[model samples]
Target chain A: MTALLERVYAWRWSVLPPITGVAMMAMIVGALVAAPREIIEGEVQRLMYLHVPAAIIMYVAFFFTAFASVMLLWKRDIRWDAAARASAIVGVFLCGIVLVTGAIWGKPIWGVYWSWDARLTSTLILFLIYCAYLLARSVAGPLDEQAARYAAIFAIIGVADIPIIQMSVRWWRTLHPQPIVFRPDPALPNEMLVVLLIGFVAVLSLATWLISLQTDTERAAQRVSALRAEFDHREIA
Target chain B: MNVLGAVVAKDLKLAWRNRSGWLSAAAFSTIAVLTYSFAFDLATGDVRPLLPGVIWTTFLFAGVFAAGQSFQDEVDDGTFDALMFSPVGATSVFAGKLVANLIALLIIEFSQLILATILFDVALLTPELLGIVLIGTIGYVSLTTLLATMGGHVRGRSVLLPVLSLPLLIPLLIGAVRATGASLGLEAGTGPWMLLLMVFAVWATLAAVLLFPTAAEQ
Candidate 1:
């Protein structure tokens, strides 16, 4: 286990960045070139590639948050808490990207930027649960690891909705289409998908870079805060 | 049993002796029902339409406020730790607290029901209707007591309890409200709603049994 962790941290430092950067470039080329031209509501539906991948990456970010939280709770390690919080930062950002890009796509396709249908409502609920996760972390304050344990507990429970959120359209036929990118006869053409795939990689690499920076900074900030508190107490005494 | 009962009696005596502590709940409950009245009564057409929602919201919040101070008193007196180590199982401590919260909740529930009648025009006083209200309150109070303990220990004593609890308590509130409303029409609440209420009751009771030790020990 220790060797595995060392490998993870080592790869996280050296290998992940280049891999992420390469993935982003692949996604961009895929989006701009690979996805084929298609029409939705009279305009080219090239955004499909970008939108779907962004949403998928957001889910990936959430998975990491949940996974890191599990490690925090199980191992009682501050580093796991840091990683979990770092992932939360990325997850929230990716969630924002999902909402924004989807809104941009929805305007032309769905005729409105928002709808209160079950699919949308469930998505909104997922957002709220994530907000609750953030709130739980903030409330835990300097006891970040303790807070991380419970926050991760909630994150783990909360991710159950991800499946529902994803398949809500399938489970119930709402305005949202079923999976368009993965099926054999994907709704979009190959060219547009290439550009979208590129856009997704760009976003994913950006997310990973930001998470690494955030996790490193959190460690520093925690140390500083502990020292400050100790100094304040000493001065008072 | 003896020690637990004695502790229960002690808590009840302490509560009764503190004029404001016991009455604090009554005062808070009264104000909460009035606020619901002010908010909902204005849309008074078929006040029955929103009766379940209105009544449940008032009762739930009122019960939260009513029972919130039970732990605050324990914490303030610095007796929570001692109570935990007493020669009694923690479940009895929970039962005692549950009883106090239940009685306090009943006071608030009945008061809110009165407010619901005058404000929301819910004709819930028929025998069957009243029984439904009693049962619903039983489920609601059980959940609230457990949640209140969780909330009462947190950063903001009173404010934290409701926000943390409302998301969870929504299903319970929905079921109770629906049951209360359905009973008014001589229709028994359907199976799923009743099951939800039972689930909530069991969840709250189990959480209380399990988690109250953390509060008591803290």
Candidate 2:
């Protein structure tokens, strides 16, 4: 079992990219060509295939960031900090995608690029919170323990705020459409559901690959900094 | 318990002695209200519909200013280091700061209420409105106090404090506005909004209790 796990770990970098690329290509075909067009909104509805999956990925990335943050605080492990930082960066990037695509979809349907509706506003706020998280990390200087702690604390607070924000905004306005994908009886027909499922797998795998690459880069950067510090101390001695 | 009281008393006393801190916050809120009144042309319209948003926004700005000043001042003057060296735990320090900030925010809210009543020609001192103000202020101050501590000693804290805290305070903002509107008869069904405000207050306080030690410890 250990040997198998090691082999898989070694092959992940080489295996993941091609698989993700293929899955992504399949998703694009499924979304554009395979799914039936809506009677009211034709091609614009296809944006849902990308929009919903990206939103899911963004939420998952932030959730992972918050989980890793809790571990960092409790275990004092720099690895967890790197994981948290990488996840947050990915989460922020995906959130931007979700917002921009949402705006594009909204333009034809809502007749405007943006609305002060509940889900849109809450997602925007989420984006701002994580962007501020990255800003706080940068401002606190590089890899400082206190900075890590602060980011961890802030991420936890932001996650905790998510439910309340959703509830309040839902009450504040109801312009956004209801969920069609995750219901007990999903509103989508069979064909669209298949495309959505494919999109989900493709996006999730892509996010995983990006987060892994980012975490590795952070770890490498930390190693270089440590080595440079060691060389400086030896020279001084 | 004694330590908590001492910390609260110390913060309150310091705020009182250095009156400019919260005083400036109050002045800022008042000026903002005046500016909004002019901008919205309060004389020609029924400003009742707009009063809830104005009141809440002003209170939010004031609360952020006071919370940031209270923490950053301690860090700047090195008093936070001395306090950390003392026998007090982080919870006491956090709870104390929270209470002090709560009182300061309440004062600002009440003053803003009066200013709105006079400027917007709306009676805002009703029982329901008062209760909403109290609960909303508690949540707002609780959240800002935590973020202010986290942002303290970091560069560009003046920018960091609001950016960090405001997104988290959206629920409070929404709840307060709707509840206030309900109480003032511009909207209906205050129950859900008030419940949201109460839940947010409790969650913020609990989170601060759990996280303050990690933030405050050296």
Interface root-mean-square deviation of model 2 in angstroms is 1.3
User: Compared with the real two-chain complex, what DockQ does model 2 have?
Assistant: 0.73
Q: Return the lDDT, model 1, position B16.
A: 70
Quote the RMSD, in angstroms, for model 1: 4.9
- Interface RMSD values for the candidates, listed in order? 5.5, 1.3
TM-score of chain A of 1: 0.79
Best by TM-score: 2
Recovered native contacts, candidate 1: 0.02
Tens digit of per-residue lDDT, candidate 1, span B1-218: 78667767776776677647657766766676667667766445766666666667767776666665666677667676687777776778777877766665666567666765666565666765565556666665654565455433357647765654455454466567666666665345445556556666665566556545543444
Steric clash pairs (candidate 2): none
Clashes of 2: 0
lDDT of 1 by residue, A5-58 (tens): 777766776766787788776775565565544544444355555567667777
Worst lDDT run of 10 residues, candidate 1 chain B, spans: B144-153
Worst 10 residues of 2 chain B by lDDT: B147-156
The two-chain DockQ for each candidate, comma-separated, is 0.18, 0.73
